[model samples]
Target chain A: MIWNERIECATRDEMRIIQSERLSETVKRIYHSVPYYRKKMQDAGLTPNDIEDIDDLRKLPFTTKIDLRDNYPFGLFTVPMSEIVRLHASSGTTGKPTVVGYTRKDIQMWAEVVTRSLCMAGVHRNDIVQIAYGYGLFTGGLGLHYGTENLGASVIPISGGNTTKQIQLMEDFGSSVLCCTPSYALNIAEVIKEMKVDISKLKLRVGIFGAEPWSEAMRKEIESKLKIKAIDIYGLSEIVGPGVSCECEEQCGMHINEDHFLPEVIDPETLEPVAPGEIGELVFSTITKEGLPLLRYRTRDLTRLHYEECACGRTLVRMEKCKGRSDDMLIIRGVNVFPSQIETVLLNMSEVEPHYLIIIDREGTLDTMSLMVEVQEQFFSDEIRKLQELRIKITKQLESVLGISVNVKLVEPKTIERTAGKAKRVIDNRSI
Target chain B: MLIKQLSVFLENKSGRLTEVSKILGDCGINMLAFSVADTSEFGILRLIVSDPERACKVLHDNDFSVNLTEVVCMNCPNEPGALAKALQILSDNQITIAYLYAFSTGDSANVVLKPDQLEECIKVLQEHKMELIEASTLYKI
Candidate 1:
């Protein structure tokens, strides 16, 4: 079921040659077209000519999320606006969003890689895929959509949310494959149980879950609850989206789309490549991307790469499930949120003290964020309505900034815990 | 007349109310009238104490978010329609009441009312011949 046997099962030497050629071309294009990359390379005392092969990847400077934020909307795009056929964005640390563009050929390449990923999951042209990842701006929905279509499979295109309707479509359309976040799959499973919908009657057989880090225990829970084989998919919007890697039926580790996205695991401290099979921050270089091709982009995700051949017969390197993040970024309901963002919102409001605590918990397959804020003495009111109004105001401000509703609990002053001299900001109770 | 009511912010957890009462009692502060306004997560305990300044200071030293709020206290006969008649005066003058609570003594009941306009509420109630208790008198009682 491998989509491209020549690329998927290529010998190490053959793959290295392919990577060398693409890496050289990408380096040359970005150096000439993008001033940011040119300046970065110039500061590093390296030129496109210095990058001759895949071996020279470490010599190139690493691009981080800060670089993307600095460029903002279109400063990093190597191609012109007309050349970009599609655009997707995810939340940045602060107010602005990190945007990525795709040219026509880039989109085609995306579809190809995702198509290959679906094949790795045993999906064929006859399979019906119900895409539940959110569409528009977020990469999960449209990325899987194009890939599923490229595979010649029937796409339900049922974007995220609306659990009852998703269940109804699963039964009516006889969808054999489901694509969504792992937590949403569990949520759907709970709805199915509550509604007493017979899971045995549904034609669903495989679920490809991604866009958030999940655990092995959660995978077992989703698989047993939904009566399907849950495959973990890995991708970030900064990379080429969900098609970057996917797990095979063997379910050992997700197969990295090495031909399209060159994968590396580096020690976060020293920024040096870790020993094989050692967990480190995952990095990617978009070798074939035309619109927003990145060179040695540092993806803060922490995971190890396995070079051994998988039972699924694909030579593409496999990455173990992401353990955690190198930074303090949290993915709540597939939305990237930083504690600093919440701090910024709290600091702007005068009614509440700057001291706040964020508690993340999972209630019935959904992530819930409870923010405990200390009420300021000047804003404390005897009237219940005024206090309620203050709570609602803080909640609204937080939701607007974080793009997710948060449960704001107004507590008395000095209630949030402080250890030594520093205040503890986040308390995550979720296992994943 | 306006009475200084101490309002304390309390999380809806066991032993919090008891702790506040214990702290005030230990400090020899007598609570004249108290009302609790609560939601699911937290509660606001409003108290009229003999030594409000001392009670507020002790509660503040104990790390409780306590503040002073001015509320109108009126003395009404301990009859069924006594509260209704006093409230009718404010209602006729279009004076909105935010919240009200009462405590009965021997022959009359002391009603604590927080209205939208404090000065106008006092003038309207006084114009209707309502008995407005002074803060010192209420605190002594």
Candidate 2:
């Protein structure tokens, strides 16, 4: 079932050889064509020749989203505008979006990697992939679209919204492979229940969910609800969209496309590499990109990398699910609160479901955090004392885990607004 | 005798209590008696209603966390010493009352109370020969 067996299941020595050659070529190309990267390396007193292999990646200057922002629209692109065939940008709420461009070969490489990703999820040529990721400058929709086509699968490019339609088309089209953010998948599952569509009737057997960090609890919820094997896919617009890596059928860790992308885990504080299997910020270097190949780009995602062989028979190095992004960590009254940590606590409790919103507001100079949790149908009843006890129990568990007392509010089922994309979990109203 | 009481948790908002009462009123469920317990952030509304299950259903459907609890009700003589006599019997029997509220009706006063030990309080009341109102009779009233 391995899509690109030579690439995905390559031995460590073979991958190192391919990565070494690609890294050398990419570093030289970007250094000569991209002035932004050239100045960065010149200022760091290094040359493309200095980066002879993948080991020399540490010697290169690290590129970040801020660096891309400084470059703005096409300042970081290594190719001419005429040569670039496609362009995509990360959704930026504030100012300039992080722009990415691809030459024809780069787009082909993107398709190849994503084709391999779909194959890892057991999607075949005969399978139907319903892509719900938004199409446009956001790379997810089109990236998966082309990849599904490349894999010879029938793709339903039903891009994002109109939940009822998404479900109807999914059933009518007999979609076997579903691609979207995990939160949107959950929203679809909720709508399916609301519409009383029998889940057993749907042809979904595999799901490729990503674009935001999700937890094991969420994976379990999506899998059981949709009756599919939920596989986590990881990518960014900077790293050639949603096929930088993917979890195989083993469901252990995501196998990074090591031949095209070099993966590294570095300690966020020290800016040094962390020990194997230790958590740190994930860094990637695009070795085969043609349009805007980057060198040592810091991803800000926190996760560990495993190099061992997978039971699914892929030797491609795998990365564990990201804990959270460094910037996504919320400091609540001097306590660190990760939405994943709260998710972990909620998923362990039987009375409450994993759907929740963390609201942080300020009173005078102090900060206050409130958790709005949905009570399960079996848990929600006419027993006020039991509800109060459940609320208190959740509050205590959250307080113990977060080291700050959280005001737990019991909300009715499905009261929270479900988005067709990444779920907004934290709302800090201190500024407003 | 045990009487059913409905307790609801409400956010400390201006129109929260009104919303609960309005929903109950619209459902034609009459509140026989009720009490409010408040903290800085939230409040609990304990009610003795004509139909506990129906009132609870209506309030819950309106998104209120509601519960039903069994409370002891007693009929005391509507005299100055009548209340003191009932309290003395319980105090002597070592049965503590968590909370109690009384309303006078004609010549008799009905007092609803939550006791630490329901069986002990009832046995003490019967031994003292105090009139205990049956829930069926109270509901009819």
Model 1, backbone clash pairs (residues 3+ apart or across chains), number: 0
Going through the candidates in order, the fraction of native interface contacts each one reproduces equals: 0.76, 0.05
* lDDT of each residue in A1-432, candidate 1, tens digit only: 999999999888899999999999999999999999999999999999999999899999999888999999899999899999898988887777899999999899999999998999899999999999999999999999999999999999889999999999998889999999999999999999988999999999999999898988999999999999999888888888898999999999999999889998999999999998899999999999999998888888999999888888889999999888898999999989988888888878876678889999999789999999987678888989999998999999989888889999999887887789766889999988
Q: Residue B98 of model 2: what lDDT? A: 69
Write out the backbone clash pairs for model 1.
Answer: none
Off by over 4 Å in 2: A329-432, B1-141
Who wins the TM-score comparison? 1
lDDT of 2 by residue, A1-432 (tens): 888888877889999999999999998898888888888899999998998888898898788877887888898898789999998876332234578999999999999999999989988999989999888877889999999999999989999879899999988889998998776788889899999999999999999988766678879988999999999998988889899999999999999998988999999889999988899999999998988888888888899999999998999999998776766666443233568778878888877778899898766434688998876545653334556778889998877666568988876446567889999889878542
Superposition TM-score, candidate 1 onto the true structure: 0.97
DockQ of 2: 0.07
Clashes of 2: 1
Worst 10 residues of 2 chain A by lDDT: A89-98
Give the CAPRI class of candidate 1: medium
Compose the digit string of candidate 2's lDDT tens values, residues B20-122: 8888898888777778875555566788877888887887777666778788889988877988989998998889876777766678788988888988898
TM-score of 2: 0.60
